[model samples]
Target: MFGRPTDIDCDLWRTDGALLIENAISSDELAGLREAFSRCAEQAKPDWLSGVRAGTRPAAFFDLPDPMGLDDRFLEIVDHPSFYGHLMAFSEGQVIFLSPQFRTVPAAPLSYVGWHYDVHRESTPLHMIGADLSG
Candidate 1:
């Protein structure tokens, strides 16, 4: 059989429409993701101040809901081929390589995030709509 899948398909780079692929990751991957996060928290540089401080706004901290123990699974789902295909379909082949992925965790005592576009620069086209996804 083929080795564990690694590369994401190239078709996910469209810039026009929006695509939201739901429930992409597997259950096992979710567990792995959780364990990895826990390990990171344990090993994180505690001396560093949380959030933006001093000249900037401080960062926010929160916990992710884990009832299904699907942290890693969720991540895996997003990275799956079908999700990438959807993203590619939205982009329409105009792929702007940015960060590897976007992630958010809604912890208890949940804070509200304001509705805003991903880009605020003058070059960002006025017609570029923002895509918001939540579970």
Candidate 2:
């Protein structure tokens, strides 16, 4: 089991467009996720992921788009009880899982993503669930 979201978390999501649920998953689950993530990265094409290139922002890191097909563990995260309820609360029951991307920043002197919204075609809503795989 994982941590549940409080009213404050939901409010942050609704107002600030993002929410961070601390200790949402157990350490074991987190370890499993990290392993799965590494496996997925290993299977990726060499050119699929690249460091920031000329004309790109300092934080411009490419993503391994749609990694769910690469591993079943990713699918488990979709409906995982830990943060699923939070998603439901934030979206008011409008839970639609669209893009699942895995992004990583390379070792650099500076790394920072400018403030911006992740917009999809047709102006789709974003309910991003991010994990810090820096460990």
Candidate 3:
């Protein structure tokens, strides 16, 4: 559905506000996302990317040998016009970047991850309900 704002009498930005949903992206946009991810992988240097150690559940990290280089792609995704718009909409206009991490799930015997919240332990209580613009 189109998410274009209408002349409706509602303020969805208030705390505990109800959201007006919309299907923003088309199937083509979904495909583009998949392609971009694949291209990123293809362009990445195998040796520069390494797996993370197994965690309590299952997890592995990609050690971008060059943070600067890998960061370019990460920034691309975060700043991409279309992609960023979609992300902001889904997050209800609340999203911020604290840090970035890359992880890869290789074949069996290597891929594993546990369910966990991304919030920092120290920031608990003030639970990350909405995005915090500052890092």
Candidate 4:
């Protein structure tokens, strides 16, 4: 599912508070995930779509905070062998598995999440796992 974690991976996480694991999923898995995402987006609530399409400027991306209910694949990934171990390693075996969110960035010439802070302003450290399905 993923390569074994390295000392460097842990070091990066400790120092920068972020780490990148490349090719974490097989191409076939990626394709399936992309298809699932598209299907869910197509059937998304109008309000969700509207929030994404809102704002004067083109939106950078939109997130479905409660995406686990949208598809079975979303639930399958919670204990997936791919990156769960790495997550545990980074969190010192004190990891809490929150329902993963689904975020989509529409195709645009300049697709970027501009300057802004996340919604929650708590000081508690948070760990995030993100996958780029763009082929």
Off by over 4 Å in 2: 1-20, 45-60, 109-135
lDDT of each: 0.42, 0.66, 0.46, 0.67
How many collisions per candidate?
18, 0, 4, 0
TM-score of predicted structure 1: 0.42
- Give the per-residue lDDT of model 2 (tens digit) for 1-135: 544678788678779977766676789887998998887777653545333333433334556657888778788878888788777766778988767777775656433344336564444233233346668
C-alpha TM-score for every candidate: 0.42, 0.61, 0.37, 0.61
What tens-digit string does per-residue lDDT give for candidate 1 at 1-135?
111212333233233233333455556765777776665444442422333344233244323334224344445544366456555444564646443432333353433233225654445443333344543
Candidate 3 lDDT over residue span 1-135, tens digit each: 223332341344343344433443456665765565556556754433333222323334343333335434445555555445544655668978754545455655524333336654445422213354445
Candidate 1 Cα misplacement greater than 4 A, ranges? 1-23, 50-59, 62-79, 100-135
In Å, residue 29's CA in model 2 sits off its true spot by: 0.9
Residue 101, model 2: Cα distance from true site in angstroms: 0.7
